[model samples]
Target chain A: MNAPAAQSVSPAPQQGGRPSPPALRFDNVTLGYDRHPAVHHLHLDIAPGSLTAIVGPNGAGKSTLLKAAAGLIRPLDGVIQRGVPARRIAYLPQAAALDNSFPLTVYDLVAMGLWERCGLFGRIGQRHAPRIAEALRAVGLTGLERRPIGALSGGQLQRALFARLLLQDAALILLDEPFNALDAATVADLTALIHRWRDEGRTVLAALHDLELVRASFPQTLLLARELIACGPTDVVLTDANLARARRMSEAPDPHAAPCVRAA
Target chain B: MHAIYAWLIGPFVEFDFLRRALVGALALSLSGAPVGVFLMLRRMSLTGDAMAHAILPGAAIGYLLYGLSLPAMTFGGLAAGFVVALLAGAVARLTQLREDASMAAFYLLSLALGVTIVSLRGSNVDLLHVLFGSVLALDDATLILLGAVAVITLFSLAALWRPLVVECVDPGFLRSVSRAGAPTHLIFLVLLVLNLVAGFHALGTLLAVGVIVLPAVSARFWARQVTGMAGVAIIVAALSGWLGLALSYHHGLPAGPAIILVAGGIYVLSLLLGRVGGLVWRALPGRHLEA
Candidate 1:
């Protein structure tokens, strides 16, 4: 399939005529478990206020990259620098990662987003009440505040999680498969919120599988297969050739192996 | 009214041992029950059981060394409990064995070592008292120790409340937000060891977990929220203590086992009749649909 033309190719220039620093920069970073690199030698920059989609086939290090950005895991070989402090970033793992059996109310779970401000000892001040209410209303979950999170349907749980993201109000947001298993209505609502965040000058990087959705909404894309295949404006980065290259690159065996590498 | 007074009030008013037993049991229930509630919530009930067993070798060593010295036994139990927990946690992290399996292995070894040590130094009577406890024989020193543990546990639990809840619900989220996660977990383990050591003085290691776990599990059937569950568990624990002391006074039953048996009875009853999610509620027509 032909890739769509880029709609917002260039970021708006600053008043001083200097390009803004990237919100996140990965310098030759390699991340893995048990010494098997899932993402290797990745040099990339996520520009401030940009909404970027990361897409590739299964096991393409999409989630690993997001975890590194969130500072949940350390890189084995290189560095990741964030313009904002780690607390100023919000990360939402795949819904499956959460234990729904936990007996927490929707209100309590969403209130966790305020932990950066309230901390372990501080009370949720009255000033935060309006914001929490607004976030819940924004996600269409105002009426479900008192209900247990386990009682929520999958779509409702996704909405509740989005409500939490709204509360986080982070400068940089990393979402891993946020729209997986979501119905069309929930996806549309969440997509509009993402657009609003971009309009508000917040940076968002989402790992997505739906190329059609990526082409429609994301102005930039990073195509990966365990390493960077392409990174640029969406239309230029997501060409048929790039995807085929990623697939072939992912399927091929490692040629840099020492003879004893397998044993190690 | 007379029968009630005779069965409950008369024992405590008439006998000094009964009053002391009641006080010690209440102190244990206050702190131990809440810990149990969290243990059950984290699905670490078996770990709590294992930790209790692990305390035995240390207490036995103390018994062997100091000849029933309360301070020595308490210190030894705390040290041994902490060591086993740390070793099990380390082994689980570094090896292919799951945490539960490692904890089980360590605790079993501790139990065997403890029984051997006790048998080496004392008679069968001494072993029986150590295994089942002498709730009626609590001295002023033991009472003071139990009270101190309760106070410290309550304060520490209050300070660690928010972080502990976050850790139990989603440890990864806790780690992502702040550096308090590991310390919060460590503090919780310390509290567990302290409460278990305190419990050993009254109910013995074998039966102390009953006071901690039974009431908490029973409360699970009745309360939907964490605080609510803890509150219910505390009440259940206190009630078992009082009723168990009464039965021991009037009927000449063993005090520790009586308390545990009372708590077990409540657990069974709550499983059938509790308001939150009892078997009876599930059995009722249309109740499942409503729930």
Candidate 2:
């Protein structure tokens, strides 16, 4: 399958040189469900147009952080300042987050990427068709437009989701475990798309499990173990000492920990 | 040829009550069936059934307040349904119980309370009428109410269609992108309660949900998209109403149960023969597609 160039899809308009602010700033943010803090004492600043990998052990709150950035959850304490509007943000949660059993065609699902532009009642005119078709073509899903999403293979579904993301033309993209259970080829194709988005100057944050892929592709990395372990160049953050500390901190979670109260 | 006419068309043509009943059933089918399809898609079919029962107390209160007044009972039923829905949701959020469990508890109480309230003032005949419904007794006022409900339900469904679909498919995504998710959900609940209130007038509280749910579930076998499923559901529901009413005319059977039973039969047939994922289609191993 060919990896069609995404330039024909909505290209991000060129912005001339200007002092860039942090794409996101997490100020002492604490996020969890039901007062149980999955992420605590986190302070980080993400530069504009940076492709960062958030790596952590199981239960280390990678998904939680992305969700907070997407404004899906409120911070239990402190603040997270997102530089983009909700419409300018595109979030691709885990595959399990979507109801794959829903009866939707690939074309229709991809068309949803036009939501920010068309809105609830806006018509999808003749002009919009080519954009949707180009998105599908970019992700190698051109011929499968009519197929029901339930009939799609895992790889094809992920590709279709990527097509939707491509159409989003978002300034900031948050991906939560996007490549789990996918073939190597699918991963490669998707990674290429991510690179294209980065080239077009979009801030991309991905919660990833694959250290090798992160090392090769992601320039910056944030290692988390319920708290900020390290954030720097991928090589520096993924060091032996930092990895061991992350694993140790994430291993034991107190079931009966007292209600957290931290003074600034 | 005349026998066909006598069997199928004669009863509807001859009796004014039969014609009214047919129109009432068709209205329910048009509006209620699509709502059922959404309920089924959301896996809230039983919840819809529970909600149908939850309106009993409200209608009963109306019946108690004004003797068989349509407007009173309709308002009471609507208020009651909304109260129960909100109560169940609150209970689920505040306490350890899930929404379904709380809904179940509320509906049972509502049903019993409604029945007691009705028997407090009315006779066994009236109790039967409230429980089993009186399709043959539908008046012009009731007919107009049914038509209006159909129009409102369809228009609301169309207006909220996109957000509703996004909410169903990926709620977290919807929440992230737009605020339409929660408001759209609230409006959908209103539609559900409204349809149930309208349905109860024709089919009674106990059996109103049957017309709503049966056609929606059956539609799953035939269509693989929301629009297709709703279309199939409307057709199946309308057909069931016609056949069920015809059966009542010829066999001296009760009308509500007869209609539901015909819908049940269609559900079974769709289960066997439907093209998308029906039993027979699944059972037969078809040729694999070329990649």
Candidate 3:
């Protein structure tokens, strides 16, 4: 029942001629509801140390693609190859996914990432302790460790999740809409955190909604709308043509928008 | 007075059963407190009710085979409860039915199955005892089993604590973070079922739930954090259990329900007087404080 986490690790250092494995690969991946496909022929590669944002309007399968990568929903076709098993992948889902009524502290919320390493019916170890503290510190949540999670603001909760991602010590991290309900300041702080993670040789794939923020922040893009509309550099892919195509895709359901320009 | 105090405290001061009842209450409180806190959050205290009922058929089977062996029956009951919960989970996921509907259905099915199983053995008296436990009948064997289950539940809770909390509050996001949320939650419910079954021998079905429920409910008014709530719950449960025993020694009412009632009374008191969850606090005097 636990969702598979997408990690924030680099192509794990390898020996011999095994070229560094792609951080994530969706090869001809067709994903959708039972028998009905949403996103099809989705061939995409996520390079290590790269921060790729999967952006599209609502119902665009942006969340779906991330879910497929995390192995939450079985892809209708194709495989989601990771450098290692799904365990090495750390995931930070959207803040909206959390129920605030749960009675736990910020510290308790972050501690769950270490459960897999704890072994079944096993005791916690000394080595993982420092990492937990370090992760919390990295998020600037050192003193708010024991604060009840329910009491935290949206930004604090998001940071707490980032701390959990840190606990995974993963080479790659997949985050879905992690900055949806944040203030401008929080968005900036989280953006800085993402940059820091990427600078540390980690790859971060996020599903972001803010177009300007996505353009300003992430260098890579995966423009999706029930399909892989475009996949490449932000500047290249966010061109008027692709943007118009994306806008057309967005207007598909509405039917009330102006006609999109097909640039040469 | 000295002689009377000796009679009151002597059994506890010397023999082990009296000591264990208190210890058992503490253990039950440790689990029940968090369970109560979560139940409040989820509004699924009813699930606890259904789970309590579900343990019956399993415990009845264990008892029919083992002749009141606490460990034997507890393990059986725990396993049965887990199966029922799994069935409920599957039903919720596969069908359009909500989790509450699944819980209600499972509760009735398991309760009936247990009664049918008990009738197969033709021991109405035994079933009644299991239904309403006589804690005085709980021997050292039951205590040991309770202790083991308690330890396992505690360790599991601690290990999965972080993800479980996150999952409970924000399962959608919890899903993306790591595959830690829902699995941890399933495992937690399994552990909860195990604890309830373990309490079956000493606490009975009805009172076991009450014990599991009220201490934490009462403690909620006093604490905001999980750790604080757990601490207060243990204290409340231990006190109630000890007080119930004393009251029972003086008046010949049943011990388990008496213990639960004491806890319920504490809950009532908290509701009236507590600054947080109590009823009247959100009204006149509360408004006056702000003014």
lDDT of each: 0.87, 0.89, 0.74
TM-score, predicted candidate 1 vs. hidden true structure: 0.94
Model 3 has an lDDT value of 0.74
lDDT of 3 by residue, A130-220 (tens): 8778889988789898787777877888888878777767777888898887888878877898898888988888998888998899888
lDDT of 3 by residue, B12-41 (tens): 777566677777777776666666666555
Flag regions of model 3 displaced more than 4 Å.
A1-21, A83-85, A110-143, A166-168, A250-264, B1-44, B59-80, B113-127, B140-148, B151-163, B166-187, B274-291
Q: Candidate 2 lDDT, tens digit per residue, A11-124?
A: 222378664667788877889987888998777778778888999998999999998998888999988987887789999987746787999899988988888998887887
- Positional deviation of residue A192's Cα in model 3 after best superposition, in angstroms: 2.3
> By descending TM-score, how would the candidates be arranged?
1, 2, 3
**True-vs-predicted CA distance for residue A33, candidate 2, Å:** 3.6
Please provide, for model 2 over B1-291, each residue's C-alpha lDDT reduced to its tens digit, 9 standing for 90 to 100. Answer: 999899999999999999999999999999999999999988899999899989988989999999899999999999999999999989999999999999999999999999999999999998888888888899999999999999999999999888888888878767777888868878998999999998999989888999999999999999888999999999999999999999998999999899999999999999999997788989996998896
Model 3 chain A scores worst on lDDT over the 10 consecutive residues at: A1-10
Of the two candidates 2 and 3, the one with more favorable DockQ, higher being better, is 2
Which candidate leads in DockQ?
2
Residue A221 lDDT in candidate 1: 93
Clashing pairs in 2: none
Ranking by DockQ: 2, 1, 3
